[model samples]
Target: MKLKTLVGTFALAALPASMSFAWADAAPEMTDAERAQAKQIYFERCAGCHGVLRKGATGKNLEPHWTKTLQDGNKVEGGTLKLGTNRLERIIAYGTDGGMVNYDDILSEKEINLMARYIQQTPDAPPEFSLKDMRDSWKLIVPKDKRPTRQMNKINLQNVFAVTLRDAGKLALIDGDTHKIWKVLDTGYAVHISRLSASGRYVYTVGRDGLTTIIDMWFEEPTTVASVRLGSDARSVDVSKFKGYEDKYLIGGTYWPPQYSIMDGETLEPIKIVSTRGQTVDGEYHPEPRVASIVASMTKPEWVVNVKETGQILLVDYTDLKNLKTTTIESAKFLHDGGWDGSKRYFMVAANASNKVAAVDTKTGKLAALVDTAKIPHPGRGANFIHPQYGPVWATGHLGDAVVSLISTPSEEAKYAKYKGNNWKVVQELKMPGAGNLFVKTHPKSTHFWADAPMNPEREVAESVYVFDMGDLDKAPVQLNVAKDSGLPETTAVRRAVQPEYNLAGDEVWISLWGGKTDQSAIVIYDDKTLKLKKVITDPAVVTPTGKFNVFNTMHDVY
Candidate 1:
């Protein structure tokens, strides 16, 4: 039976008539008077859809979504509610659009803040499906259309790598085992950051544009979809692995290097905003503005987070999706991008400011380890975040001198290292044959096909794809220049950040490349085992207005 059908079948039998809600994390402490006022405010305005209990009458239960992720790559479910500062601000400024309304003009920001505080202090649960029960329902159904038809290979030293890409405003997916290209499924929103569930059953993504979408791996159609308006633009998003709280979610802020916006995952309700004071030095003054205005200034940058100003990270409980916290770290600098390891034990981000990768222990809420990537490159304004496989991390530096660093766990460390130890050294730094530092990739399935130049477009630097020799880092990563006979001529130019991903079967690597002159985008499939070019699929739908071309910035995630 198909996965979706199986899930539907089980859902029909396993799901109880009603579920009891529970908060997973403790709420941030507040005063009694303030708490009372907050409760009154919540019922006055928010109770229409969200129950007076802040649970939910017409919407989702906020209590069950509060759980978060753990270091073991598992989820910690059930805790008390905490109304983090950011969570309060967002909820007041932007009311939800679909089931909720904009509150910027209706309620004073102060009222919203107090109400959020009260809600956080007060814990409540509504009826819903338990994780175990939900999983059972999914198990008896047919999987989504994107699941692989062929048998998957046993992941080994040669086969693990994460494929990075963008989806249609949705979460991207990478095969959990091989890190190869899995199908890129739409999460229901323009994806800024994509995250997977602890069990790899769901993929989550949100955008600065105030859109959030979640995709169910077991369902053929969308499992659950919701969005919230932050009023101020958003910066980044992180999904917790905590059990019971898998439904919980949170987003970051931005505006002059904006702060993060925290929200409710299950109901798509805005909660609060985390802000960083802008510098007033040099007699220059800066005031925070709406996110939409700030985003209009950039020419082509995708997302921006000023870790220098705000050393804050957002956390949420997956169970109730009600509790949230934004912690600030002092004396920290140059934080780079991050991703969760396979075990879900931890999620590490590049602290480019400190010249080291800071690994945050999800369970203890501590800075567990800092692996130095000293020789690689200096931290800069832009850094790309990629999760090759669940555990191993991949990052590309803009200031780093032509190199890609790969950090692996105990099991895959040796294969990631060029020489002896795979501790904190540059595993591989392939000099960019091009000018910009931007880089993206798809999964590595077969070694059959390679990147090469086209004969038609233009003869610049032999415009082609460079294949790297994973075994050697110091020597130049091998570049495979496709011959004129290989599909499009060797001279055709492709865009930047075009990563190829391997399918679940580990046979094909799918790549979306931009055609320089044709102003068109082409999806190239490389035969992994043979390292040869296979087929090029062109899309006329993606056309740029000015350049008469359509281009894909990053490889969207595989579902």
Candidate 2:
């Protein structure tokens, strides 16, 4: 049977008599086909924030059971009073004020009703994916020997943008120089991140559906050279970046089955799989400690694998995958995406639920520090810059709070010797207009820091971006409404401006104006210095564009 068919097949049989409340009778019973369709919709749309099991992280838990602890500290449980079928349907169709996007524009009325019922039923326990299964799913479309040995096109390879065409399961390679779509190739469903190989030749993308694809940039028109299924669901993927291990091994982290897979970097052949299910930082067993993000260390021949719920950061030595040596360091929980500091020695990541940012020293393979920050820090490879007062610092925006946090970082430069005391501390918090900020970014060559609030509840703030001047810290950021700047006709659905990325030269900043599949989406480029609209690249081919990764910038780990 297909995965979707298997998804909720056990729901009816496994549900207890008490769970089948009279309220559930109001919600229509779903046929096998309806169940499959609803399951797929949830996987593509809701699984990222809310887990496959529907036990939430960033979003609220959608489990069939609800346990409420009253002020007296007594467990009040009879049935799911908080989430009846009627209430679930309303929430699914209209969404909530807490950063959840409404499905009115994205899904049809019937589809929304289907999802409402699907979540109220028992969530299926997806089958575990073994290394053998991954090997069976691996496909080498173009062998390494068959790929080109040299650049075959005149296009500026460094400026190429691997734009994630979300909802369409494809990636568009756009020329930053000419603002043209060079080629569009198939990728996984809702590709989360596009990681570049150290040599800047291979582009690796891992989607929410756990499909990892490797595209060869050396091809005449960038082609999908290799592909593999990491698991039922995946988020992060990266190639080994150390000097001797450039593109030697690839690591993909999955959300379901709670594991990560290692493969040959060139061919994407599965080598080993490691389960992340273990005790959380609090020493309690967590069955679904999903592997959130994986980063290749520059100082050591290891990969920094962060297990989300467990708050355990594993430094897996790539030199010996056979008898794999892993050093696990305990830190704060809800660990999410992160990047290297200015020195590239300290890897800083957000322990968002803990409201802290955990810094790991790769050199020592130990927990350096866990600095407290604003609520729900969602830093997307956070911005690194030299502070006028605090010396070198890292920046992160929040999802639950309205502020961009600046944490001082240690640096070796003699010029920054005076601010050594400020290292690993939250130096400042720039107030934002609203909450629900997902990504913050900056460039070494650029004079500004860029942040996006696409997750903001309000349409005005959600459709705009803020730019901060590095020279003047006291001044407020200039908010640019990118949705209006795109020059596209207004649509009823909110067009979110997200993932501000810089060109290879850092002269241009591209913002993806993500909209519904039917809406006209655009890639808005702005002059980094002038902060003026340069070009709005809108093509019918660029549908539901979200994350844009520049080839050179991503390869070098440029913020």
Top candidate by TM-score: 2
Q: List model 1 lDDT by residue over 404-512, tens digit each.
A: 4555432235553433244333454445453222233333332222222221122232234555533333455455443231354432233422333455555665554
Instruction: Give me the displacement of residue 166 in model 1, in angstroms.
Output: 8.1
Which regions of candidate 2 deviate over 4 angstroms? 1-28, 67-81
The residue-by-residue lDDT of candidate 2 on 126-220, one tens digit each, is: 99999999999999999989999898989888899999999899999999889999999999998999999887888899988899999998878
Cα error of candidate 2 at position 544, Å = 0.3
| TM-scores of the models, in the order given | 0.47, 0.92
TM-score of 2: 0.92
Model 1: per-residue Cα lDDT at residue 189 = 26
Q: Could you give the C-alpha RMSD of every candidate to the true structure, in order shown?
A: 20.9, 6.1
Per-model clash counts, in order, read 130, 0
lDDT of each: 0.37, 0.85
